[model samples]
Target chain A: MAKVYNFSSGPAVLPHSVLAEAQSELLDWHGSGMSVMEMSHRGKEFMEIIHDAEHDLRRLMAIPENYRVLFLQGGASQQFSMVPLNLLGEKKSVDVVNTGHWSKLAIKEAKHYAKVNVVASSEDRNFSYVPAEDTWQCDPNAAYLHYTSNETIGGLQFPFVPTPPEGVPLVCDMSSEFLSHEIDVNRFGLIYAGAQKNIGPSGLTVVIVREDLLDRALRITPTMLNYRVHADADSMYNTPATFPIYIAGLVLKWIEEQGGIKGIAARNEEKAGLLYHTIDSSGGFYSSHIETPFRSKMNVTFRLRDESLNDSFVSEAKKNGLVQLKGHRVVGGMRASIYNAMPIEGVKSLVHFMQDFARQHG
Target chain B: MAKVYNFSSGPAVLPHSVLAEAQSELLDWHGSGMSVMEMSHRGKEFMEIIHDAEHDLRRLMAIPENYRVLFLQGGASQQFSMVPLNLLGEKKSVDVVNTGHWSKLAIKEAKHYAKVNVVASSEDRNFSYVPAEDTWQCDPNAAYLHYTSNETIGGLQFPFVPTPPEGVPLVCDMSSEFLSHEIDVNRFGLIYAGAQKNIGPSGLTVVIVREDLLDRALRITPTMLNYRVHADADSMYNTPATFPIYIAGLVLKWIEEQGGIKGIAARNEEKAGLLYHTIDSSGGFYSSHIETPFRSKMNVTFRLRDESLNDSFVSEAKKNGLVQLKGHRVVGGMRASIYNAMPIEGVKSLVHFMQDFARQHG
Candidate 1:
């Protein structure tokens, strides 16, 4: 069909190679006479898929030995509540850094379970920048300090992790930025990412949680939400999202073929730089919403000076084979989400389209 | 490539045509220039997939207009806890019928949320037979009466759903036997099945619930666990198991291509009858655990009288391209789970192998 570049934020782009390999193996995976979708989760074939996917992810993320990598369902939205349910049982209060719409939502969900302390927020400035980590007023006796590292809605990101006081753990919702760069796995007690963004698919949410935080969930925590149960069963306390897991495994293999997280990260940075530099050089024709230091490398948000030109820009871009360039509803501007699978060529084409669109409207 | 038949229960077998279609569309679904896994859940492409899948399922199952079909994650195991959390909020107790390991597990999980009362049990008989519905003492004021229609581990099945007292709802855990035959959807308030068995894959659980049961969830229930949220969103409140949903949709289409559920059910009966006849005609050489009425049409469980022939039976059967014939560890015997995707030829070949093996061992 159509030669196109998809930039729909999440359930976004995946490596073409991963999908190709998965399609080829869909019917009779390795001559087993059944698709991976039809293979038993408890069977030898699926066991290998799960084992290798987990091991590859651990290696790619440099996860510590004590950390449990869980392939869970319900996405990061579920984790918004699950984190507090699992972590804030002992303490009555949780410290949160409100970056944007997602962190605000997370804080709202956590309120049902615990007393939330909004230590710092960029809300006053319209979430156009990340509040400095030094300004965070963490609760020393708090169970955990949580923050959203990258806000998908606002196209904002924290350049560094917030430091919590002693006895408090740091938790980050790294949904939009995970695997786009290397992370120090030991820095946080827990980190969760919805796979729709930078990882594989939407159904799967990858959680890298430290062992120490596995226990101590409240009595009200559903057995399915218990981190310890999933960790103990290796994400198989119940049947997992097998097809997503299999496709994710294929994505992981693709990442390895691209020389792991480091290589992919470097490529992502280059792609992001091309788009950002193009916007920067546009000389008032195009304006980026987030301040320079806090802009996301994964999603570059910009706007045109002429408000009415937005429609033409998006529609014309679609005709030019660049799709999903419209901004998120909450943010009325344009956004190009250059996720892990987005090639430099795709970004270059977007930059070309943006420049052409600017010239036509200029 | 070595040809082999996979007999692992649930995530068991899929029609080869379905797999071939999925394989063909893996990278670029219907020329959308994106894999179904990579499409946004809210986008039109993915929405079409969900709508068509639900429509196809409703037609295949003959689900009533009042029933809301939900595609959920966390499998049937999650439903064990969610059922009580959602349905048991207004009532003081719920009734359960224990037939085998899975039903017992369901009861165990339900007890944490509700005062679960065992109405009838076959555990006294070593789970070799189903407890009759007439013997059940379900409380009229109970929230719901639950039963596992087909016990996966013990290979027992309730011959029919127990008639609940007028005010109490009847719920069936049809995890292992959904879509194997025709059923009256109006008879039960809710029917759930994990897709791995006969539907499509793990991770996606199909819940057919009467719309009235949507409310009454406990205050502390996770938003994702609430059936109301899933029903309202058409099972897209969060990012769904898109790839598996696509596969399930394809399977539904394949079912229609094979002359719909009624036609497939008849074929299933013939296949099951052939295998059961093989065991019964073996003349004391092979013994089945479950009574005739409770024997499953999907999973046929039988053991040689000598018991010493078990290993040799599984081993030599593997040599003839049959695999995973071993029973669950909790129940030591041979189980051939011939789900919907298992062709008559496969069963005929399996029967011939069983006959040859019996002649040699007997």
Candidate 2:
């Protein structure tokens, strides 16, 4: 069957080979006489699947021995609430760098549980770039400093990890760009990512938190929402989304087959670089408002200079087997989310379509 | 490929045809050019999938317009916390009847958020039967009355719905018995089920709550845990368990093909009857202690009278293509969870194995 290049920001493109392998085993996984979904979560088959998923993720990210990897549900949005509930400890406030769309959501949820001290915000310039580090108002007495590594909607990337004052931990929501690139895991106190973007699918969230941070939940925290409850149970406090975890395990293997984090990052660099090059060299025909230094390689956003041609650009691109090129309504123009699974060929096909359309409408 | 009869409780069997159909469409659903797992939850394709799932479920169960159906996460265990937080309203206490292991868990979680009144408990009888309804000390001023429609671990089920005092709402955790048969949704203020039992898979949870009961959630309820938040957003408050919901929709259609709810109920009655009859006739060879009238059709728990035969029974059953017959530690017996997807043939096979083993060991 022919497959199209999918650029959906999330519930995004998955590795083609991984999908094929899952299809072949949908009815019987490794002669187990059951689909991955039908297996008991505590049964040996699923135990190994979850075990391997956490193992591979930890290996790929170089997660330290002091951290516990929790495969949780409820997306990064739920983490927005859990962050303050678990990490605020006895302190009453948290410092956050407001990069763009995703950070603003984190801030809103944080304010519900703690005093949010906005260290700095790039919103003053329509969020085109990350505000300079020297401008950030670090709170020495704050419990932690939080930031989004990648703002999936606005396509802005933080080029550097923010440093917190002594005794204050760092946290990040790396949903869009996790596993696409390598990073030092020791810097952050907690890191979480929704699987839909670059890992597997919706319904699974990966949280790697330093073991010491496990306690300190608020008095009113729901048991399920408390980090310690899940960590103690090895994430099996309940049936832990068996099917998605299986697929994530497969994705982890695919990540290794692509030669681990370094290889995936290089491939993502090639795909994003090609698409952005097409946008850049199109002269005034195509425009990207984000400052070049802080643009995201995961989600490449741009606009057709003649906005009236938007429908034709997206629809006509779909006709040529490139789909979901329309950007989020908040950012409104075009977004080509070229994650690790997006082959250079798909980005090339998108680039070819872009150049031809620009020539015709220039 | 040869398949075995799976008897694990909760993350149990799914209809074979549904699995096959999902396998066929795993790569490109309806030529949408992406796997169901890959489709954006907000996209048109996913919208249709979720819309049809809710429609078919409503049709099968005859759910009323006064209730809102939500596809959620965190499983039924999460609902333990959600129930007390959402249903306690202005009342100081809630009434509950403890039947088995599941009810006890619900009671434990409830005690954290509300004043819990244990109206009755069958635990005194080792949870082998439901305590007499006449003995229940229900509080008329309680916020709502809570019960477990079925206990998966003990294989005990309620033969009839319990009525709360006038104007005190009724809530039920029907996780293990939902969709095995139909019931009057009007009797309850809220009903929740984890889908792994009979619907689809582990990650997604199905919730049906009266719209009027939606507003009683405590202020501390996380936005994602609030029924009103999901109901208002049509369960897309954030990205839901997309793939599980799609598979659940397929299983709902399969239920219709197998003669809808009435047909399913009759089939369940026949399977449960055959297994129970076989156990009773075995005399000293096999035994089930649950008062026969209250035995669950979904999970049939039994034991070989000779305790030492336990390991061989499970291992032999596995060798013969019947698996996961080991019961929960609390029950100390064999449990064959013959859910909706479990064919009558699987039960017949178990019965045959039982009779043959009895003759050899007797």
Instruction: Tell me the tens digit of each residue's lDDT in model 2 across B122-227.
Output: 8888888988789899999998999999999999999999988899889999999999887999999999999999999999999999999999988777888889
For candidate 1, what is the lDDT? 0.87
- Please, what are the lDDT tens digits per residue for candidate 2 over residues A154-211? 9999888888898889999999999988899999999999999988989999999999
Best by DockQ: 2
Q: List-wise, what DockQ does each model earn?
A: 0.69, 0.78
Chain A TM-score of each candidate structure, as shown: 0.98, 0.99
In order, the Cα lDDT scores of the candidates are 0.87, 0.92
Q: Please give each candidate's TM-score.
A: 0.98, 0.99
Candidate 2 is scored at a TM of: 0.99
Model 2 deviation from the true structure expressed as Cα RMSD, one decimal place: 1.0
Candidate 1 segments whose C-alpha is farther than 4 A from its true place: none
What would the TM-score be for candidate 1 when compared with the true structure? 0.98
- Report the Cα lDDT for residue A311, model 2: 99
